[model samples]
Target: VNCNCDYGCPCQFNARPTDGTCRAVVAWRIDSGHFGDTRLDGLHAVNIYAWPGAIHEGNGSMQSIIDERASDAQRTALVAILQGEGADPGAVMLQIYRTMCTAAHEPLYEPIHLDIDIAERTARLSIPGLVDSAVEPIRNPVTGAPHRARVDLPFGKEFRLAEVASGRTRATGVIPLELANT
Candidate 1:
């Protein structure tokens, strides 16, 4: 996930953004998972979002992208899950994010390449003409050495623990985004 915020996004702590607005590009690589009986393994997806104000204030726009290698059935199932269908209210991050956005652009089926290593605090995501993003360990301002940090949300819906690293993203789509060191 890359967004226009300082390292350690304030939103994770329920605080206002570093700036007044919000723009983000997030990608997910499903190593192994299942949506009911559907085998959702080795698939990737990306979401782009922007808002004029805080997320809860509404009037946001979003675009979804799915891996082209998925089968028809896999695509349908992934779309449903992305749209928050059949899930209990606010049970998932995608579901909650969808409700906050007013404009939902048509989803794109395209080639996606993603690699993530949580322990190493490294990641790379590419969607051809859509986006190019990467993540790496934060560096110490004085020593220029890799600085490691983490965030743990005991009851958070998005993730239980996340390695806090620097992220950069450039996206060109319905909801464009350009973020650096965030």
Candidate 2:
């Protein structure tokens, strides 16, 4: 999924996480896949955490976690795809995950929880010990009104618009995501 991290992520600014450095964890479960003749079925999850001095500079480190149930071939294919291989160029999902990463960590196997309700402006992503992130509409302080902000990237491979707001977050392994006063 596409995300808004301050004005410029290290990748965009040729730097690290907007707050001086770069660090984030991205995990996903593939419901289905077919890399050539290889069948990738069942539930699979992977996590990527990284810290870069500047995203464009390309010297950041990263950690990858994959589901233990995957076969050796499946694991290799997923890693390659996540690392920006075999996919179309300019595919933001793969490109962004790859270019900005500098260091690589061993993959882990674990359960990941994910839920999304774009229409309701709510989303949650979490892992037992790795991450827990949530997104919702921003609210007005005095009236408790929900404020909504959208960033449109017409050419971006991700969504064209993203709602920014104040959200509650609790992430330990990666940088904590707290939607605050957007």
Candidate 3:
């Protein structure tokens, strides 16, 4: 998920909230999987982003953007999973967005550009004006030091532990996302 938050999101600090809310865009490329018994392969991605006033608040908004190449069946499968279904309970993205979102933007069909190098803590996710985000490491302002931080969730959804860094963000859609090098 590519998110637009104040550099290091407050959620990591166990503090209040970022941007006084949570505004983010999440997209995943399913290299291999299945919704029930239906095969879900050949690069399937969805953008589920939101703006939450607080971690537990329930009045923000969200949008889901899908790949245009997906067929009707594949689209439905991906949308269902993204819309807070078939996932585990209290999974941060799904549950949080479903309850807090007030408005639901229509799902979009467009080509999504995605790249990742977890070992190097690097990733690039692009969806045109809707989203263009990149994540890298956080560097010192004065000494120009490179700082690194990481969050690990043993049984948590998404990734186990992601290296969090400062990143750049640019968005033209309702959902906002920012990225930086950690």
Candidate 4:
């Protein structure tokens, strides 16, 4: 969730985004999954996005990057899923987001690197020539000790549970994304 939102994002609570605009670099690291016959284990993906105002207001742009390690079948399947064509309608947020966006770029293939520690609220996700992003535990402003927090939502669109942390990201793509302290 490396987005252009302030720490403790208001969107989580149905409030407006801090800056009244929305753009982000979201990702998924598939530890294990299957797309029909092709195995998607150890694959990674990124979705870069930009929006005019509030997300629900519509009008946005999107770009995607998929791991090059995947086979042609895997790539096709992944692209379909990203375009909200491979899943049950309205089952996932991508379906709705895909509809709101005005543009979706051609997917890029690259070697992805990802290391995630959910408990530690940390991750490093990179796609060469596309994006570099990292998340880490927030630090106490006063004592400088590691601060830990978690977001729990019984009916959240993004996740039912998530660790809260500080993050940084810079992306190079058709829909460029840049944010810090996300």
- Give all TM-scores, in the order shown: 0.94, 0.69, 0.80, 0.94
lDDT of 2 at 17: 54
Instruction: Give the winner by lDDT: 1 or 4.
Output: 1
- Point out the higher-scoring one by lDDT: 1 or 3: 1
Model 4: residues >4 Å from true position, as ranges? none
Write one digit per residue (lDDT tens) for candidate 3, span 1-182: 54556554666656666557666656677778988876778664755555556646677777788877888887887777767777667765675567566777777778888887767766687887777777666677888776677777786444577777766656677665544431
lDDT of 4 by residue, 10-29 (tens): 88899999899988888889
**Candidate 1: tens digits of C-alpha lDDT, residues 31-146:** 89988889989999888899888787878898889899999888988888887888788888788888889998998999999998876779999888989999999999999999
Q: Count the backbone clashes (under 3 Å) in each candidate.
A: 0, 16, 20, 0
Candidate 1, residue 109: lDDT: 98
Q: Relative to the true structure, how large is the alpha-carbon lDDT of every model?
A: 0.87, 0.57, 0.67, 0.86
lDDT for 107 (candidate 1): 89
Instruction: Quote the lDDT for 14 in model 4.
Output: 90
Model 1: CA > 4 A from native: none
Better of 1 and 2 by lDDT: 1
* Residue-wise C-alpha lDDT for candidate 2, range 1-182, written one tens digit per residue: 32235632324333345555545545565668767777777655644444444455567655555666678887787677667777666665656656666556665566667676768777677678765666667666789777666666675444556555444444554334333322
